[model samples]
Target chain A: MKKENISDAVIRRLPRYYRHLNELCSRGVVRISSHSLGQEMSITASQIRQDFSCFGEFGQQGYGYNVEELKAEIGHILGVDNDHHLIMIGVGNLGHALLQNFPFSQCGFTVDAAFDVSPAVIGTAVNGVPICSMSELDTFIQSHSVDVVVLTIPQTVAQDTADHLISLGVKGFWNFTNIELSSQVPDVQFENIHFADSLLTLSYRIANR
Target chain B: MKKENISDAVIRRLPRYYRHLNELCSRGVVRISSHSLGQEMSITASQIRQDFSCFGEFGQQGYGYNVEELKAEIGHILGVDNDHHLIMIGVGNLGHALLQNFPFSQCGFTVDAAFDVSPAVIGTAVNGVPICSMSELDTFIQSHSVDVVVLTIPQTVAQDTADHLISLGVKGFWNFTNIELSSQVPDVQFENIHFADSLLTLSYRIANR
Candidate 1:
């Protein structure tokens, strides 16, 4: 597989495969063909082959891919090979829940600090991740050199917070603000997880069905 | 937009455009050309025009689109024109937070019921939405015919829960589980929200930058 130029869509699906492979490995499945894996994912075998080929050839024609090896490879490709340091912005209900659950460090990403506007929550800690005031974002980010930010701010302040983070040299944002931020910051990537959008998509599928 | 045969990718982007337009409206922007909206989204004006054209011609060549009108049209296209009924599975930390925050009814979706395995949580109410045992899911779903199901279950039970929902004729799912589910029922749509994937994409972008 090539080390450069992976499509965003393909990159998005790597975790899906990695997770499935992990499950299969746990279930004692040692090998899988692109066809079977694609069947499980509802994608075409050829498409799976092409996506995998872009990274590097890990499967043999007749023998297929080794489940454990494929899981490790996909994990590395998805950049979960190393532990990541993350900070959460807006430690509200959603942020608090995310902080308490989803032990990312155990899975290769760590939430080291949390930020909020409320003084009440500022000094508290969720899951041992210290909650700090938004005023400390720049210093905390600079000192910790945080690699990713989980944005759980309100829709109104989403864009401004994103801009501020970008200016502070933050390269990636996991935005849960429900705001559509369309800025081109040279090396930064933003993933929008809009609750409304998710529900709407579900409604469409249900109505259509 | 056409009411039929809309691609899933296009459907997904409608909410994005809707949110973007909402922001513009809040800022007191009256109208926007497709070119400018496209630039904001990192897409081309013609592509934006084409997407809007699928439903109906909402823009003029010289005048562009009315901000409010376009927002309304997108809302309709995404089927958020009216309120939708939503149910939650796994009423744990994430589920509790979702119920308390992001009240979807305001945006056209309402959380009517929640299901969990915990006896302590069952028969309780979170933000007016009643929590029931998993055993009651089928009856509740049949009675209400919930339009969407939000799955915040653990990874191990994710697929089983999805299967249960689909068996009871669930059409759409907002899956927050780390596990990726492929639909066996063609009408059932599953949106896998991987927190890790977002972090990985951010890490990749940051590293590359």
Candidate 2:
């Protein structure tokens, strides 16, 4: 779809829009005006209209938007409708918790395998996803088509692990190592999740308030 | 500290700067120029200078910024030096993992307690933090000076739970409930963590690339 001039900010908002639409769909809401949707999401109606215009028109002048239709469109833009094979590195407390709790399938990601350096968790399984040893990672990636690698590994090894994964043809990364991972490879994409950053932001707000 | 007119974007970047400066301090790098810092962070040197100027004069014309001083100043701005007593709600897998793994004390947040509705985990503890029954939440908050509440609860009850906690005078929230928790209370601040958004962003880049 027309993604040429779309900003990263707009791309990030697509998921939020998709999520709201999913909620509306579940509630059996068929349609919504930009004004009402914007009010609920704390966004401006004009901004909402402008963001949607980057992809394509989903609403008429007075008819508003079809909830399911808008949701499907945004989901399509987010590539959430595509089947993605994902693997997790570092089956630590955080990794194990994610494997057990996160609804990865809802966003079209399936955790086919999880790799860990620990012998204790290597043969174990969390929610049917097998936890394999680090030694088998190369062979598994060679045999399986892994589209995304979840890096819950330590900060020291996160970059090296990501580089190795990139060499193995993995292009997407969901990194939780707190260190920002940047690759020299052009096609490699990383989304770093820093819990400390979020907490510090909250603390800043509280302190400033 | 001159906090007025500081934009949210600038506020968000404070933690990142704090983290980088922290690494520099640990590595015995006493000083750094904004150009070098900006290059490493992928931010413009002018933007870095502008963001730091919002707090105060951090670096001299040619002397550059003292690593320890900048880190401490940013930490103070982010309230990392304050002793914040944080209590976590919902001692599920995610909560358990966070309690076990997250270095909250580094950011001046201590997980004094965790609450769970489930009787199975009510009396247990994760990483020395006691898991209390949800029934005791009110009493616990009444007695303890809790500055922040970590919501790891289900989406269905997230808003209601936040409202209840707001009524109890808690103002800061680190929410992992997937749902956006908004409060009518003027002082309450929420930091929502959406793993799906990050994952979807990664997926979108992968698909679009």
Candidate 3:
């Protein structure tokens, strides 16, 4: 199926499917029926079938799905097989946290370098990746083929920074800036990190409960 | 409207509506048509109308929605009007980033205090909130009315920490532990923050493009 035809709801659920399948595979789960998979994920068995049907079939009538094979299939569809090159802009606390904590390489993204304007942080290194100055961003982008950029910059300069990166041939962005940069440039691919939205949803549950 | 009936899709969209309406209200855009709102958000106007309908009426036909009024309505529906007290566990890199950067007070959750195990960090102040020892968590929770707990702890100790807090009377959690804790406790509430999912989505976009 083409990307345009897939609903946002389906696209969003893709990662979860990939993650669940990965867990099952790691734990030596040979196979999983939609009903049991649904139980693990808290989704309905029919809904699980429907979500997977949007992509393609990986199961039979009563045979269920092979955990490793299904995971590999979903991984291919989600592009988890691609070794994406990433550069983090703004090496603040959040940047450091991501650099130190996130298993980017294991997940198929290699964070080659990080950039920042802070003099104290510019020369510093985290996880053996050199932190470059803001002035070197254009050079860095030119020298290395950067696929995705992680924006940890302040909101004031977020869009401008993104525009600069896009102009410099960056393909996509993993934005953490509080602003809505995705909407500004429709042609550019963006995955906005909106933490507050989750917090608000949690609040809604609390209030509703 | 009841919680169970409302689809997760619609509940997730409420934040976007709240955020967009907030921006519109801030920009002095008093009124907005569904069509314009849809265009701005990259959603269908009918979808926007349908999502809003899940809550309550905040607009009139042809007249459009009052941005400020609608924002306030959504804010209330999202429990943004309620003051939520938050206690952050593990004042590490991610924790510090959140405390220093995120606008918790502005978003209805006030981060009253933080906790850490390290001697170097304990008793330190981040954004005026004191970081106490992890041993004091029970006492702190007992003394204060903490509605939400921010778990920035390691995955190994995450569930145990959550269980400890729940026994201490905490109602909810905003989890970034990289492990699923919400499903373990069926009756409890949580919003898991997964940054890796966004990276995977970005990878998909890059590969597909």
Candidate 4:
């Protein structure tokens, strides 16, 4: 499928498909049909086919898709085929854990440095990624050419940190702050994962369901 | 508008609107039009109007919505106006920090208890919420009647944890694990936040844009 044709929703589901395929591959499953894949993903078979067809044909009439090849395709599409540099902001509890248990490296993105406002956390290393002061953000971004920033700062400071990163030419942000920053930066692609908002929405669904 | 008429996408965006309005209300902004709200959210004005219309008609012909009233209405729609009990599974770094920071109570969700397998973390309080053993999950959940669960377990254990929670009658899940479990539980609402996938998609968009 052409990258330009892929929707944001489809792109988000690619990693999901990749992770499931990895599990199936580990279990010695060689191939999977769109129907079964859809069943596993709780989506319709035709939806799976349509999503996959956006890039290129990968399924045969009866043979379905080769697990390993599909996995590789998704990995490449996600840019995990090439290692990307990551810099994390806010070495607080969540940030510290993220740095320690960094998952991107396994999927081809590595955290080279971390930044924080806490003096106690500075000069420390979580999973060998050294924590630096927030004052060094511009220098670090310039030196490392950090492509992605993992934001775990407080809600009040999220916008400022985002502005700083964007000023440094950072391409994308994984924002974990509860604050909504849709108006702060228009050019940068931001993925806001508000934990409280998610829980509240879920609660509402469960109560109303 | 009737709650049944609200789409999932619209429901998801309600929180974003709520956050934005809350910020505006705090800043003493009394009124906002659909155009201005859409501008702030990076969405179209008509789309914002449609979403709000699903809840109720709050805007006038020329005038928009009252900032404070809109914020409260959105909060009510999201079920964040009243306090709801919440439980956290996998009290690791992310969990601990989330407990410490993030005003869940202010948002009408409270982290009453946290569960983990580690004995060291058990019986301890991370930001006033008591850390409990995984063995106590059923008891705590049942007694507290927690409607929502915040999952931060490893991908390997996410499915099992979800299954266990579902079996206990938990209806809502905010899953942070990269692993997708859409097929594992069909009835309950599942919101998956894959940080890597978000970052990758954002990077791709930034690179292509």
Candidate 5:
């Protein structure tokens, strides 16, 4: 399967397809045509075929696609089977919430530990994930093969924290800090989540509508 | 301003521009050239100029852009001046975290109330925003100007909850449920936050690298 030359738009759509297929699998749906899947996802059938074709054909012309097989294939392409190790940088409100609720394991990642500056939460745990002091972060990352660092710290310290983590061999970042983190190091992936952006986008739609 | 023909890509960049301009304003930077701004944002100078052109001319030909003025103009275009009224549905971990930390007021939104089915939190408040029973939702929305609903509910009830909120006159949604909400009502806007998609994107990069 050719992964190179795939558009970012198609890569972004893979998770949506993975999610929708998960729902279909749970409901005992075995197979679906591009037209039926398109209707369910609100995407065009031809567009679905085109996207799937980017990763090699997962469907036959007449027999459609096997739901479970397609989901597993997409999951593999998304690296869900790799079991990436993750750590949270700030055990703040958002970080605490994510630790409590986010299905990280289901998405092929594990929270090895969390680090925070606050003394009150230093030894405590959220959803069984221990909150360690910031001083222990370097040692923890060195000992553990930490792949992604979840940044839920204040924007003022976000970049510095990320830089420090990157130096400790962290390869990816799931950033919740309002500020964007641009790593000077190559091969470091940053997925910055700007809640305000989503809010502003919604506001724009509401205002225009 | 010609808002009609503005592409979604440009709309998405408005918030980033707003954020960077804000950083500049806080630092007392008075003006910037499109080339410098583009460098800061990693976007091209011509692209920045073209995006701003979709709205209107907010810069001088040679003097560049007045930092505060351009930020304010972009803010206005993103409806940050509208003072949108917002409420949170499902006071779960994610919703609780948002209410406690999200800078809603900075983006021209006010959280009026939060709703949950749990009796333990029904009369409580997070960051002074009262948490009411879900039963009171209809009456509260009936009496107040609810512009948006923040959904952090379970995916199982996400669609029904959104439908009910839409029926009660909510025009916007900042949806955090794992499921996507497609409102049958016209003019309703949904900004679905899929954390898994972001995570998967990161994982893809890691695996491919």
Candidate 6:
């Protein structure tokens, strides 16, 4: 299927669909109608069918969808089958939580190493990924095949560090830095995780209440 | 302004506008036009005008929007003017990270207290927010008015814990337990922070490359 034809909303929902289907598969549910799936996801069955149709036919008439096959197709669509390498920057509390709890390898990315400026955390390792000094970052990127750099560093240095990484041919960033990046470098693909925006959205809900 | 008439998309963008305006304010930019604001936000000038117009007439025609006034209006609309109390239920690494870094008070939600089951971590205070025992959860809710609960525990007990909280009249949850909750509970607002979804979204972008 030509990706350019697919709307970003459909592409974003692909993961949610994959997640729901995986849950069903784990529960020994073999087949599920779009109507049932719709009820579960709070989206219309027609919408679900339309979304899946964007990637070619995967559902059967009357029989509905096969859980394993549908999930596998979505896994492929989400690039979970293809291995992606991630290098983490800043071994602070947030970084440490992500490095420990997030099953990166299962979801297509493997964190190869981490880098930190603080002397206290520089020589340590979190779950086998060694933390190196900032001096080693440029050389490490040059030597290793790093696909994405996960930034959880301070906002003060976030822009400079991101620009430096992008210059080293790194094309993807999972940025958590509060700098609202893309202000400096505008080229690469980025999934800017703005946690504050999410919090404020919730705050708005309370205020409205 | 009647918030009921506004779309969720507009409300979500409100926080983003607040953030951008805050930056301009910090830089001493007093007034800005829709055209310049749109250019900075990568949104259409007409779209920005439309969004702000939903919350009544705040923009002055021909002159432009006052940066400080616009931001303060958005902040008030988001309920940042009202104080919100939150109880964090799991003092794990993620919890600790939020406690140490996230300025919840600035966003209108104050971290009243934290609770944990780990013997090693219990009886500790993170940034002066005392950590209490799980036994205190029910009693604490009965005594104090907590607007939300931050969950960072294992998925296995997430639903049970959430059910327990909701039964105790807790209406909001900042869940990070990896469980897509909402089982047997109703009428509560939730902002599920699926960090994995954000990561997988980035992975898909990388794989598509």
Best lDDT goes to which candidate? 2
**Tens digit of per-residue lDDT, candidate 2, span B54-134:** 988999889899888889889998999888999999887788778877899999898899999898988888899999999
Writing each residue's lDDT as its tens digit, candidate 1 over B98-182 gives: 8877758756787888999999998889989899998988888888868778888888888887887788888778888866686
lDDT (Cα, tens digit) per residue for candidate 6, span A1-209: 44665665677788889889889998999999999999998789999999998888999999999999999988888888888889999999899899988889878898899999999989889988999999999999999999889999988998888888888888888988867777344448778887778888888876676
Model 4, A111-166: lDDT tens digits are 88888888998998888889999888887778776777888887788887777677
Model 4 DockQ, alpha carbons vs. true complex: 0.48
Superposing every Cα of model 1 onto the true structure, what RMSD results?
3.8
- As a TM-score, model 2 comes out at 0.89
- Looking at model 2, what is the TM-score of chain A? 0.96
Q: Give the C-alpha miss distance for residue B20 in model 2, angstroms.
A: 2.6
Q: What is the C-alpha local distance difference test score of candidate 4?
A: 0.78
Calculate DockQ per candidate and list them: 0.46, 0.68, 0.75, 0.48, 0.64, 0.63
**Chain B vs. true chain B: TM-score per candidate:** 0.91, 0.96, 0.95, 0.91, 0.96, 0.93
Which of the predicted structures, 1 or 5, would earn the higher lDDT when compared with the native? 5
Stretches of model 3 off by over 4 angstroms after superposition: A1-4, A182-186, B1-4, B183-186
Local lDDT at B93 for model 2:
72
- Over B1-209, each residue of candidate 6 has an lDDT whose tens digit, in order, gives 55675676787788889889999999999999999999998778999999988888888889899999999998888878778899999988889988988878878888889999988888889998999999888999999999989998888999999999988999988888878888455558788887777878887777665
lDDT of each: 0.79, 0.89, 0.86, 0.78, 0.88, 0.86
DockQ of candidate model 2: 0.68
* Residue lDDT tens for model 3, A50-132: 98898788898898998888888888888777788889999888999999999898678888999999999988899988999
Q: How big is the positional error of residue B104 in model 3, measured in Å on the Cα after superposition? A: 0.8
**Model 2: residues with Cα > 4 Å off, grouped in runs:** A117-120, B62-64, B117-124
Candidate 5 chain A lDDT trough over 10 residues, lowest sum: A1-10
